[model samples]
Target: MTRSPVLELRGLSRRYGQTTVLNDIDVTIPEGSFTALLGASGCGKSTTLRIMAGLDRPSEGEVLLSGKDVSQKTTHQRNIAMVFQSYALYPHLTVFQNMALPLTMRHLSSLGRMPFVGAVAPGSSKARNLIAEKVGAAAEVLGLTDLLHRKPSSLSGGQKQRVALGRAMVRDPVLFLLDEPLSNLDARLRVKMRAELVALHRRTGRPFVYVTHDQSEAMAMADQIVVMIGGKVAQAGAPRDLYDRPASRDVATFIGHNAINLFQPADGMPGLHPAADEAVIGLRPEHLSPAATGALEANLETAEYLGSEIILALRSERGTEIRAIAPGDYAIPAPGSPVRLGFEPTRLHLFDEQTGKRLEVAS
Candidate 1:
């Protein structure tokens, strides 16, 4: 069966007065897929989310939900739910009430919401019971059934986040747009929440468009990652694809650990075969080994022990510095000692220094 895209942004752009915050951006979020908009601050990821949520008007372009244009729809008409960085729960309301608010607003009137009369009003009892059932189910899924009576202020950070998720889930949204939902949590909690989010997406089988500046969050949660820079998409692909085969130096440096070793290629230096305009060579730390088998050798500058691994900072004879991580059990070469460095020919990444674009190396 052919699946339609859950969300699509066609020529999407946002402008504030004289400045353009998001340029003509176009993207397709696949159905039931968890896609992340990954970028640093001020890169327009949040603006893009607002546009998707119908909270912000775009200067150009349209937002399509299930192949229909929702750009002109109001926030309430979109049927899309958002979980913000701040939980945004009502301070006075208990978790149960908070989760039930959306349903109550949809089904009950002002006169029907009063305490004594509300319970007896025609159809109010049935509606209230239905809302209660939905809220209870959502709470169970979020593991918040135990904290149903607690107010937002009384619950811990992670618990409050579960309440927020439960609230959004109760709405039965077609799409979930999360804007750094885990940003307010502590480091360990953030990791825990990341796993929960992945599991939640799997359980719901819903399309989730998540926005976050944290690369680790994107790497760990997203099935597809859209890397943004200067209000435009720098690159978008699978996390492992982006890590192993970056399209540019910007992408390579931004997505992974270990600073890449960049060097100008001389006239055919052994395995250092150069591509067109290939002045820079990029190699991951694991690609560089101390074994004397490949094309280069460098003198060890220093080594730092990191429990399970050791980071070696080395300087090539021609002044190209590289960092390599080896197993902690491996004997680290002493500083100032010359050691041979080996790299797989296919593992070598060539880049055009001027443009920082990846160059295809000939096999």
Candidate 2:
């Protein structure tokens, strides 16, 4: 079934004085989909997310939520929950209290929020019970039930993140926005949290807009990735689509784990297709490897042995640096030895030499 769009940004642009931060941006987030706003630092991805969450307004554009124009709505009025890079938990409050804060503020009156007086304030007891139930349910889902009594200062990085997520979950907002939520964690913990977040998204069944500069995180977590560069959308599509058919030279270099090897006509490598005469060719390291009867020849500079594969760095005859992946079991020749690299003709990507845009060529 095709889900309708839950959020849309049309002709969005942000400017501060004479400087423009975002330019004519258009993005669509489908219902129940996890969409990642991916880009490098200072590329306006965070600004775009802020606009969507109603924390910031676009200098020119409309933000639509479920088909209604919400450009002027406040963050509270949008019914959206946001989790920042910082855990943003209260140091003085226990996990349970932190998780319950949003519910108490929304459901209880100001007079009913006083510490001791709140207990006897009119209708406070009922709201407290409701808040407890919601907070408990959210904590259970996040596996924080046993640690609910601990303060933020006493929790590990991952635990504090979970508490933050629990707070957001209790709100049951129409949408969830996370801004680099895992960047602060250790590498191993970041991977673990990525899976947990995916599970949480599945359970909530609500749309998620995640802002991240890490391409690997975006590829692993999001169903849709919007790549922004220079304050404009460079490309937006599925992970496989972006990897297999990058719209431009910049995206090809950014989306892959190992930087892609780019060869210009001036390098003068042999056996290139006639189409390569006026175009720049890109080949991913994984798709290019050492073969006995390879078409391109280079001298091995170094080799890095990962558990599953060996990354071979080499310099071509024209001094173009290239990276290739070899099977873990493959025997590596000594450094400075000549190596022949081979790749499938179909794996080649051609880009215009002058404009850097991808060019389609017959395989």
Candidate 3:
């Protein structure tokens, strides 16, 4: 039997005046699963996250957590934690103070929160001790045990992010929302933190809704990916599923895990009509080859030398351009030389000319 989703967005949408920011969005996030909201800027990914966080309200829909509607609840009432791309750490607060804030507020009374009153308030010492224990454990897990006393300004970018994450962890939330959390880091640090963040998720066993515009980041980190465009959901699935079998020409071009080449039947390829009529032909660069005897004719345009492979650009007889990836050691023709390109009949993809949606054919 399949497990129920931990969270659900039912008929979610957001609109302003005549413009719709989000169009009938529906999503379900599984328990302990990492789901990425992937899209370009202004695709409403950040707006969707805000709706879930109660920072923004949906015009028509419910945000449900564990089957209960939390749409009307405040951010604190929803028991969710959020980490922003800015790291949002208080510069004056020590790592320990920042990470301990949530627990202290939850356990201490009003008087117990007063700077001096808290030192003398009854039972305040016990709450402080408990907060310390929680903060220490979180710091250890985040590899910040040695720097827990440092302020955010004194820390590195990755360190500040960890503190922000540490603050969220101490809350022990049921769900965590991250909005472009790694976007501010340098490329090298970003790669290292990606692995660390995934490990952190596994260690905590909490559900995550990560929002990012970077396709590579989503592909590398998310267990599931939701592709959004124009405030509407385009597709949601495992990273490889979207990569290998895109549902539309837009998805094909977007997943773009590799260079995707499109062609027309008029280019002289054989066995393609089932997928070519009023449909755009889709091909991965790896699926194309330069052969001695083939149906299609093209002129070599450019060859980019990647370490392990050569990416060749070509233009067909009808001026239809396509790209191909060849082995680094493969003999390459001159830029203007005429060439033959071949592809496996079974590997072609077809999409509707009008809708840009993928087409299916029976074997």
Candidate 4:
């Protein structure tokens, strides 16, 4: 049996006076799952996160948590936590203090909150001790225990990132929102953090709503991905599902490493359709292999040698350029050499050239 979504966006929309930033977006985030909203900049991905976090109000829609309307709720009232790209830690505070700020603000009031005076006053000390225990547990989970006494400035980028994550984790919110939290880290560190985050999510068993423009990040970390384009959701599905069975040519090209090729059906072609004058063809680089003899031929333009694989860029007689990835150590064809290319018909994707929508082809 299917369970209700932990978080839901119903007809969510946002507009900035004359321009619409997000348009009637709807999505369901399952409990204890990771959902990524991915797209290029200004596609309203960030706006969607803000709406769910109650940091920004939707122009016309409702935000729901466990089927309860939360559009009218404020950020603090929604039990949502966000880790920002900048790692927004307090400069003057130690790691311990930084993580404890949320708890402190929740229990303590202004002016009467000196650490020494607050320590012994009524239930303040007991509350602080409880918060410290929770913070320490979160830090340990994030591998930040050793840096608890250190200031944010002393930590490395990765460590700072962990601290930011710890800060959010301490809240134990129903939903966790991360906005490009790893974007500021180096490539190697970003990759490492992705694995850590996946492990953390599994350990915590809380729903995660991650917003990122990096397709690779979204592909690697999310159980479900929502692709946004021009303020609307283009598609939503698992990474492989989106890659293999794209609903449209736009989605096919966006999520893959190589751009999909488009071809016009030739006259007298056996399988050509009268309505299919033009068709979009999607072939991944790995799908292209050197052919000894085939119905298709192209002139090798250039070859790029990666440590593990070689990529070939070739242009066909029809001016359609394609890419092929092969073992790098193998001999590569000379530039300008005419080469035969072959592909299984079943591997090819066909989409309506006019509408850019996928077409069902018989096996």
lDDT of 4 by residue, 13-132 (tens): 899999999999999998888999999999999989988888899999888889999889987888899999899999999999999998887766553278567756777767777888
Pick the TM-score winner: 2
TM-score of each: 0.93, 0.96, 0.95, 0.92
lDDT of 2 by residue, 1-363 (tens): 388999999999999999999999999999999999999999999999999999998999899999999988988788999998998999999999999998988999999998898889999989988999999899888899999999899999999999989888898999999999999999999999999999999999999999999999999999999999999999999999999999999999999898998889887765656776678999999999999898888999999999799999999878988899999998999999999888888888999999899999776
Q: Of 3 and 4, which scores higher on lDDT?
A: 3
Residue 248, candidate 2: Cα error in Å is 0.5
Question: Between the candidate structures 2 and 4, which one is better when assessed by lDDT?
Answer: 2
In model 3, pairs of residues that clash are none
> Cα miss at 55, model 3 (Å)?
1.5
Ranking by lDDT: 2, 3, 1, 4
- Model 1 vs truth, CA RMSD: 2.2
- Alpha-carbon error at 338 in model 4, in Å? 1.7
State the C-alpha lDDT per candidate: 0.85, 0.92, 0.86, 0.83
lDDT, candidate 3, 215-318, per-residue tens:
88999999899999889999999999898778888778787667688765566444345556456788888888777775567799999888799898988667
lDDT of 4 at 327: 74
The runs of at least 3 residues in candidate 3 whose Cα sits more than 4 Å from the true structure, single-residue gaps closed, are: 264-274
Ranking by TM-score: 2, 3, 1, 4
